[model samples]
Target: MSDMANNDLEKYAKALDNAIMKYHGLKMEEVNDTMRHLWNKTYQGTDIDGIKIRSDVEGGASKRSYNYRVVMTKDQVEMDMRGRCSAGQKMLASIIIRLALSDSFGQNCGILALDEPTNALDVENIDALAESLVDIINERKNHSNFQLIIITHDENFLRKLGQAEVMEYYWRVSRDSRQKSVIERQRFR
Candidate 1:
């Protein structure tokens, strides 16, 4: 990877970590340690033959690469390898990388947006993601320097989070020949 790409990755990782730590009232180091463990458990010893994470840069920019190895003992008698892409693994990596970057910079980022982040995630993975997000928000609240805009259709998840944190709820409804959206903002008194 080029220096610029590496730098960008580093920055992203630090930002993500800082956001999580600030929102969740947890240490940055602790979040990183948990991420590492989660990564391993999510993919290790699975039926995964091979895994690759590649980023395509626009305008002739250098690409970035990440690799993962998986081994199955009971399924095979010998070594097996294949190239595949796992969305779950990629999502986790992206979150970890961004967190790490945020943690290092200590700079305030304007907004953090997550679009359907929990999509396609299994129950266990979804729980992990929720925990991570809660931690991030808690950390931000503690530091008073973070803002988040999360878009999702998961009502259950939203309700769970809303109970613990102040949130702005928006609902879009369509009526006869008209479409309108309502926003309800809440804050701790």
Candidate 2:
């Protein structure tokens, strides 16, 4: 890469780093730890193996990888992203990365919209994820202007969330007889 290209790349990286720290109030080390923590919580059982975040800069171009695998008895096979992991695993990883990179490069918006966030997760995993999200929100509540809005049809997941004061924030979307979408906010606490 040319000097100009390298300069631009560095500038972008620096800006991204600044935003991440400013918004999330977490250092790079903390970010890694958070990722690992979330990953472990998300994949707590069964054949799903391990996860590793790798950064490599060969020559000029650079890349990052979220390497994960399935630990079988005879052989452990590395997944090619769209290769082996289940839907829930993929969704969990995506959420972790999205939250971790909550800088200008990612979703720095004050609002986080998760459509059917617990789609493929099992009961235990869903509960785990809900608890983790609540922890994250509480930790960052006074620090940033961020909110998590989850749209899911799973009643069990909603109960697992256990958001006590969610009455003011929760909303229900439904279709009327005309098939028009109608949004109803929670009227009871």
Candidate 3:
């Protein structure tokens, strides 16, 4: 189209990129701090201090795309998480990332849901996760609209989680003889 229009589009694109970069930078900082605090003993000899983002911006103006490589350090050794990490490590990292994302953007939505968060985690890691989630729940318990919904089949985990904040009951979902879904609220004693 016109040169003026092109220039305006370029400016808008740059602005968008700047906003995204700023948000990512802040989110990464939060992730780093949280990872440090939530490091689990089950993670083996490696302590994940933090994660750095290696991002490249490409393409023109409105068509720009950002390529990112999440660089994680294990015991001071730098490596890409996709390259080498156990299932439990990966799961914990995934949870940390989601928590960071929620902290960054969940204010507007005010709801966070976790499905099988304890899956693939060791006993120590499960305990750590339960404590971490309890801390989060306590932090958000005062918020009028904020809600954390956890879905899992681990009864022990539920008990561990409920010990801190009693919800009185939890919903049990099952199937009837006709295969219809049934949701019943069962109290925790």
Q: Give the lowest summed-lDDT range of ten residues in model 2.
A: 66-75
Residue-wise C-alpha lDDT for candidate 1, range 1-189, written one tens digit per residue = 699999999899878766754654444345445444445444343553222222222331134232433322233332322233357655655555555545544457646777777666666666666666776677676566577767877766666566655444544333444455545554422
Q: lDDT for each of the candidates?
A: 0.54, 0.64, 0.75
Report the alpha-carbon TM-score of model 1 versus the true structure: 0.49
Error of 2 at 123 (Å): 1.0
Which 10-residue window in model 3 sums to the lowest lDDT? 38-47
Q: Return the candidate ranking by TM-score, descending.
A: 3, 2, 1
Q: Over the stretch 14-83, how does candidate 3's per-residue lDDT look in tens digits?
A: 8987897798778767766655555542243345655655566789655778886766776688778786
| Candidate 2 per-residue C-alpha lDDT over 11-129 given as tens digits, one digit per residue, 9 for 90 to 100 | 99988866854654344445556566766666555665544344332342244233333221212654445566778877776777666556333445767777788888877778888
Worst 10 residues of 1 by lDDT: 52-61
Better of 1 and 2 by lDDT: 2
Q: Give per-model TM-scores.
A: 0.49, 0.64, 0.77
| Cα misplacement distance, residue 167 of candidate 3 (Å) | 2.6
Question: lDDT score of model 1?
Answer: 0.54
**Model 2 / residue 119 / CA error / Å:** 1.5
